[model samples]
Target: MYNRKDKQLAQKILTFSCELEEGQNVMLQLVGLNGIGLLRALVEEARAMNANPFIRIEDTEIRRILSETGDKNFWKNQAEADQLPLMKKMDAFVGIRASLNIYEQADVSREANKAYADYFVDPVHFKERVNNTSWVVLRYPSEAFAMNARMPTQRFRDFYYKACLLDYEELAGAMKPLQDRLEQTEHIRLKGEGTDIDFSVEDQTWIPCFGKRNIPDGELFSSPIRSSVNGYISYAPSVYQGKPFDFVKLDVRDGVVVDFDSSNNEALEEILDTDAGARQFGEFSFGLNPVIEEPMHDILFDEKIYGSNHLTLGNDYEIAPNGNESNIHWDLVCIGADVYLDGEKVREGRTFITDDLKGLNPENLMQ
Candidate 1:
């Protein structure tokens, strides 16, 4: 049986996030069995909206098998012949992922992962689904998710619902001033322990994201100028493609990553070497979710931690493009970074000190 929160979240996804209209089709993608309750709720919610809902279930284990066995041509065929057509036809998409074990795909070879990402994920989902359709993607609370968050199972569930069900309209209003400020700024600087970076967002558009593209979201993002990023940044620990990374540091010169180091060096090298764009910065953003405060080994959650900011490597979003494109879009987070705009210190660690932006601080936002 589905819980009330599941139904509530389902309603939000359909009505608020995707805005599923009558007679339109929305694809619901479930990545593991643990999200079955939420999936059922979404289906019911879609039907109530008079929208035709399509289901596509995927398992991480099955995906690992395919990656290990399939060749380049195999992934290409799957993307072209199967996934792209369906994604192109959909009016909206809602993806809910869960995992029994976070390391299910940890052992897949770099070559195989590259093929899967290049042929299948990039073309079908990133290009077609993201740029074309109204969509929202989030992870369902599961045992593995709770463990990653360092919380008990039931407590994590409660926290997830609370975080995801915030008053997004109010949050968006609070973010408006910051967005305006970003639009007017030319150079932005970041400083923290083991991190010092600065870049130009001159004419780039700043997008205020509040519970639209991503659930539990409170961020404002804009891509740096394609050739304007310089200086190094040390990111907090994170997980990518089911593998853990810590103390990840990158040295940048003119937007390209000149050198890098990480706890998992081999995997980090694979990501940076994916393509030409992979070495350059793509998206730069501030995290403003008041409820979340720490890394959870999940990008979806960690990228929204209130005291943090994240920079993406490779593949800028269509909404905020810096002309950097690649098979990977990695969001590396840096916590407690002081932010400066045009030489003015606007944020000191987790607190926004600017008068106009003070409402975004955790204390004020939670009020």
Candidate 2:
């Protein structure tokens, strides 16, 4: 018997998150069928609502081999099959990743990786997925994820679900104050140990993400004016594209990354070189999920850790078009950073200093 909780989660994604309507076509992309129970549940829910659901399963090991053998041309044209017609046809897309190994691609050479990513991965997969249909991406629990969180098997499972299946409706209701704050504010400043930065969001768009585009989402984002950023910022340890990096320090002046340093210098250079916009700011968001408390280097969780804030350096989101364009959109997180709105403290060290966000305080939420 499939677990009832898994089915419930699927129903939440289909009915609540994706909001699939009758006759809509939804696509499910699974990794190796590791979470087939949830997949089956999703199918049942889709049919019940008179929505059509289809699936595509991928094997990472096979892709790793392809990466080792394929050249630039191979990847450039790889997404032709799906990108041409199928992606446009889908009304919604749900991706479930249950990869057993997060470091499976760590050994892939940087030259090949960069070439393929620049030429193929960006235009084929990411661009369409973001611009065409409603999509939500999430990761299923694996031993690797548990280990990364430094928790035991059952303990991590509990933590994972607790974070994902949060009361997002309540979250949405409480986010109004912050959303309004960002919408009205023009100049925002950030400061913390090893970080101090200034940026202006004058006339920029503020987007509230509440478990729609990304699972475990509880943040509102805005774009920094392309020429209004000045100063340095630091970030916590994070893994990107199968590599571990930490202590990311960026030197930004007039909204450009002049010089940057990190624990992994080579990877840093590769990411910054992804495109022209890769060196500039894309998105700035405040983490509001009281349930997510720690940084385990997983962006989906860390970016939402209570009182945290993440700044992206790459392509601007479609919702908040910053007039910046790039194929890369990398989220770099700053833990315990104090955020200032018009020179007033609003967030400090994993807690909101403002009274409007009292509902988000840990004491209030856990109660």
Who wins the TM-score comparison? 1
User: What is the Å distance of residue 246 in model 1 from its true position?
Assistant: 1.8
TM-score for each of the candidates: 0.98, 0.95
TM-score of 1: 0.98
Worst 10 residues of 1 by lDDT: 97-106
Q: Which stretches of candidate 1 lie over 4 Å from their true place?
A: none
Query: Over the stretch 172-274, how does candidate 1's per-residue lDDT look in tens digits?
Result: 9999999999999999999999889999999998999988889989889999997989999999888887788976999999999999999999899988898
For each of the candidates, give the backbone clash count. Answer: 0, 0
Question: Across residues 1-367, which tens digit of lDDT does each residue of candidate 2 receive?
Answer: 4577778788889888898999999998887556777788888889999999988878889867777667777776776655436777889999888777777777787677766776666775667767888888888877788999889988998888888888888888888888888888989998999889999998898888889877788888888998999999999888887778967999999999999999999988987887798898889888878788888868888898888888889888778878788767778888887889899988877778679967777777666
Which candidate number has the best lDDT? Answer: 1
